[model samples]
Structure formats: C-alpha cells, structure tokens
Target: MSSWFEERRADKVADAEEQRRTRAFEAELRREERRKDRDEERADKAQARRDKALRKQARAARREKTLTPGNVYRKGTLLLVAMSALAAIPAQVAYFVKKSLMLLPVPFALEGAAWVMAAGVAYADERKLPAWVRWLLRAFCLSAAGFAARINYIHGSEQGALVGWGLAAVTMLGPLYFEVRQWVITLSAAISNPRQQAEERARRKHDRRRRRHHRDVAKVADRLVSAAPYGTLKPEEAWARAWAIVHGTTEPGMTPRMHAWAVKSAAALATAQQPLPLDSKTIRTRIEGRLHASAFVLPTASGTPLGMTKSAQVVTDLPPASKTREKTPVKPARRQPPAHRRSKGDALPFHPIAKTVAADTARKVTAVNGHH
Candidate 1:
C-alpha cells in the first residue's frame, strides 16, 4: 500500500512539471507575437513618413510650375479686368436708376454692348478675321464706353465738377483698359523674332523676284491654280508643272536647249583634256634609225673592245634577196555611158521646149562621162 501511494505521488510530480513547461511555451509564443507586432508598427510608421515626404515634395513641384511669369501675368490681368468691371458697372447702374426704374435695364444693356464688342474682337482674332472686322469691333466697343462715360458725366455734374470728371473717367477706364490690353496682346502675337522677321522679308523678296522673272510661267501657274479643284493643287506644285511645260524639262532652272549646250560643252572639254596617241609607224622608224646609228661592241677576256659590229650590216646579211619578175603594162578599158532612165510622164505628150531641154541635158552628161 505504501509503495502504491509513492507511485501516485510520483505521477502528481510529473503532471506539475508538464503544466509548468506548457505555461513557459505559451509565454514565449506571446512574446514572439508582440515582437512581430512592434516590428510591423515600425515599418508602417516609416512608410507613412515616406508617403508624407513624397506628398510634400510633389506639392512643392506643382507650386513651382504653377507660379510661372506668364501665368502670373495672365491671371493678374484677368483679376484687374474683373475688378474694373465691378467698379464701373455699379456707377452706371446708380446713374441710370436715379432717372427711372423702367430705365434700369439701360445700364446693363450699355455694359453688355461694350463687353460683347470686346468679346467679339477676341473672337475675330481667334477666327483670323480681316483687320477691318477687328477694328470695327474696337470702334463699337469704344463708342459704347464713350456713351456710358457721357451719361456718367451728366449724372455726376449735378453733384460737382470733380465728382463728374471722376465718374466719367471711371466709367471710361474699364473698356479703355480692356481695349489697350487687347491691342497689346494682338501686337505681341504679331511680333516675331528679329531673325525670323529677316527670313520672312528675304522670302518675300525672293518670291517677288521669281514672279517678276518668270512672269509668263507665273501666269500659266495662276491659270492652273484657277482651273484645278479648290485646295487640290498647291502653288509650288502648280509652279513646277508650269515650269516643266514652259521649258520642256522637269529640271528646274534649265531648258532642253541649255541641257544640250551643257552636254556639248562637256564633250568638248573632255576631248580637249584627252592625250593624243603616238603614231606606231613613226615610232618604229625612230627606233630603227637609232639602232642603225649605234654599233654593237663585244669585249675579249681582258675587257677591251675586240671590234665594232654594225647592226645595219648584220641586218643585211641576215636575210637573202629573193628573185624579181618583170611585168607588162595593160591598156585601160573604155568607160561606158550610163543608161537614161525614162520618166513616169514619158507616155504623155511634152512641150517642144521641154523635150529639147531634156535631150540637151542627157547629151551633156554622156559627153562628160566619155571625156573622163
């Protein structure tokens, strides 16, 4: 029984040890999880900081791009124009409303007309309308502004001279400023770089000179342009075609005759530059004469000249003379006169003078041949 009790005690001790180990393992696992969570939090914080920095940098870049000089000028001008309109419109409305409520729309109508005309000027420029149209819009805009100014002057005159002048000036200022701004914009658009201007001038001068020099070709080109479908043929292409038709050559600045002359001149130049060939017979004769003048010398064992042998004499001894035969002179054969060819009209009766003339000519030809 005591031994059995000891065994139960031993089992209890082992169970306690197992519980302790399980608790330690759970604590270690919790510690590991907390470490991982902390690391993840640090990484998230670092990412957030990087994103914030990037956002700030992007914002600065955008600000720098948006604050350019041209953008400032354009926005500032628009702001000033808006303020001017606000200031001017109220004065006109006050002046007109004092007269009658029924006349309330008059102020707006006058302001609208001036602004509409101003807008029309811009539209005209955009559409590339004629200068006259743009100028007409400018005139209308100014006229409306002047009429409004006069009304303001009349209304303010009841108060005082200074007030009247101030009101009139203010009333005119908006449209006048707008018109000046438009003029400035137009002139700025029209202005070109000095070099570009010079190039344009030179091009115009060249075009004028070309038209003057090729007046006939230019006329034909103009006719072609008129005859073709609208926008179908370019001026340059028409001019090229016209040049070809007039000069009978596709090459610019050259005619067929000029080409022929150039070819002939080139051929003449090539011929002049060529070296003349030496005559073979003349060279042979010169060589033979030189050989005949010099004698072939032979030396003995002591290097002294044994004797001189004439090459001409050696040449004569090299070949034997052949036999010759005499010939008898043969008599020359007599020439026969050519036969007369009958004309197609031989069957027809001829005039006496014509027959006699023909007969005389035949006899003369035969006599000449016989004498030869």
Candidate 2:
C-alpha cells in the first residue's frame, strides 16, 4: 500500500510539471504572434505612408503636365487666378479702407488664388508664359502668403497703417518678397518724394566713400606702424593718428572700428620684423659700395632722419618748435624811413625833433635839385 501511494504521488508530480511546460510554451507562442502582428502593422503603416507620398507626387506631376502651354489647364488656371484676384482685390480694399467685414470673401479668395498661382507655376514651363504672367505667378505663391502674414504682423507691431498693409499683403505675396518690397518701395519713393530719394542716395554714396577712406587709411596706418620701430609709437597711436589725418577727425581712442585695424597693424608689424637672410647684409653692403662710388653713401642701418634711435624718447627730446621754425620762411623786417627824409604830405605825428629834421632834409633836397 505504501509503495502504491508513493507511485501515485510521483505520477501526480510529473503531470504538474508537464502542464506548466505546456502553459509556458503557449505563452511564448502568443508573445511571438503579438510581436509579428506589431511588425506587420508597422510595415503596413510605413508602406501606406510611402504610397500616399508617391500618389501626391504623381498628382503634382500630372497637374503640372496639364498646366503646360496649349493645354486646358493653362487657360483654367489663368482664368481662376484673374477672377480670384479681381474679386479679392476689391473686397480686401473695401474691408481695409472702411473697416467693413461685408467683404469676408477677401482672405479666402486671395488664399485660393495664391495656391492656384503657385501650383500653375510649379507645373508650367515658365519660359512659355508671358512676362507679366510669369511675374504674377512668382509674386503669388505659397511662400508669398507666409511673407504677407509676416508683413501684416510687422505693420501691426509698428502701429503703422495695418489696414493698408493688410490690404496690400494680398498682392504682396511672392517668393521674392524682400526683393519686391525693396524695389517697390524704392520706385514709389523715387516717384512720390524724389528729393528724399535723392538725399538717401547721396547719403549712401557718402557712407560708401567714408568707408572706403577708412579702409585706405587703415591700410596706410598698418604700413606706417610696421615700418616704424616698435618703441617709436604704439600701434594704436599710429592707427589713431592715421585715422585722424585721413578722416580729418580729432576723435581719440581705439573704437570698435580700430579693433580690426589694430589687429591688421600688429600682423603687418610682425611680418616686417621677421629676420632677413644672412646674404642680405652682403647685398646691402655691395649696394652701399656702389652708391659710395657715385658720391652717395648709404647708411649702414635704416635709421630715423635725425640719426637717432627710433623711440618715444627721441621724439620727446627733440624740439618740435625748433623744427617748425626751421621749416618756416622768415621775412626780413622793413626798415623805417630816415627821420631826415620828408615828402610834401608827410609829417611825424610824434617827436618835434623829427618834424624839424624832416623840414631841414626837405630844404637840403630842394637845394640839391636846384644845383642839378
């Protein structure tokens, strides 16, 4: 009985183990099925997206082909564009000018027109289109709508004619929004206020000349500073002086403009200070010897005109007043007429003795003339 009972227990244990194994295997199979379903779903989604994109591209291509010249698409698109613009322009103008909402169709009409124009341009061979049509197409595109919206926002922020801009925005849509804006404003200003336009042009020209002069001065300063010995003047000093001389301005200090100027000057000075070849001395010597034969001896070293070391000390030690005096021409003082000489109308304002002397000299001159 005991042995039978033990055998039953062993069989029961084996059955429990088999059942657990079966459950685990089924669970694994279910997991694999779930994973496969997920993978299939993802693949289907991706394929659907690709298919949608391909369909969209195909539709665009077909639309473009239809929009080609001599096709019905061209005529339809142009008509739609013209009708939309005609309707939208008036409505927008009225709404903006009068603040009337009765022209609610304005935005919608313009948007539709822009979309149509963009699509037509995308599809058509622009070369076959008339210049005005091409211009219209480019001026009314998807990007133009965004640009117009931006302009409206800008006008609203500036507290300017928001309504005017809002109405103008309808026609202002263009891929070349900035360029169109610039040219249109320029043209309008040229027509409306020519004096202002001329002034603006002159100002721009002056600015350009000033900038050119500044750059030229900076370059010359770089050369001057490089050739000048390091101790003679700081690069900044040289640059400042150069700027003042060139621009005829007494403004001092290293300004934002001088930052780059100084950097270039330093670079030039570095290059100038670079060591020369050993043969340079021999070459210089030979040149000097030849010059000596012509009674013109060259200095062994490049030095200042005063034969002094180039330093701030040298400049400070020298008398600038003396130098100026040497350069300035002196006029000889005019000799005063002799007190004894006198003309018929002449008399000394002061000194009675001078008056007597003049009278005596006059009598003597008369006696000489009589003798002659």
* Model 2 steric clash pairs: 144-174
Can you give the TM-score per candidate against the true fold? 0.57, 0.21
Q: Least lDDT summed over 10 consecutive residues: which range in candidate 1?
A: 311-320
Taking the tens digit of each residue's C-alpha lDDT, what string does model 1 give over 17-47?
9999999999999999999999999999999
| Candidate 2 Cα outliers beyond 4 Å, as residue runs | 72-372
Writing each residue's lDDT as its tens digit, candidate 2 over 205-236 gives 97567547568676867788889887897766
lDDT of 1 at 44: 100
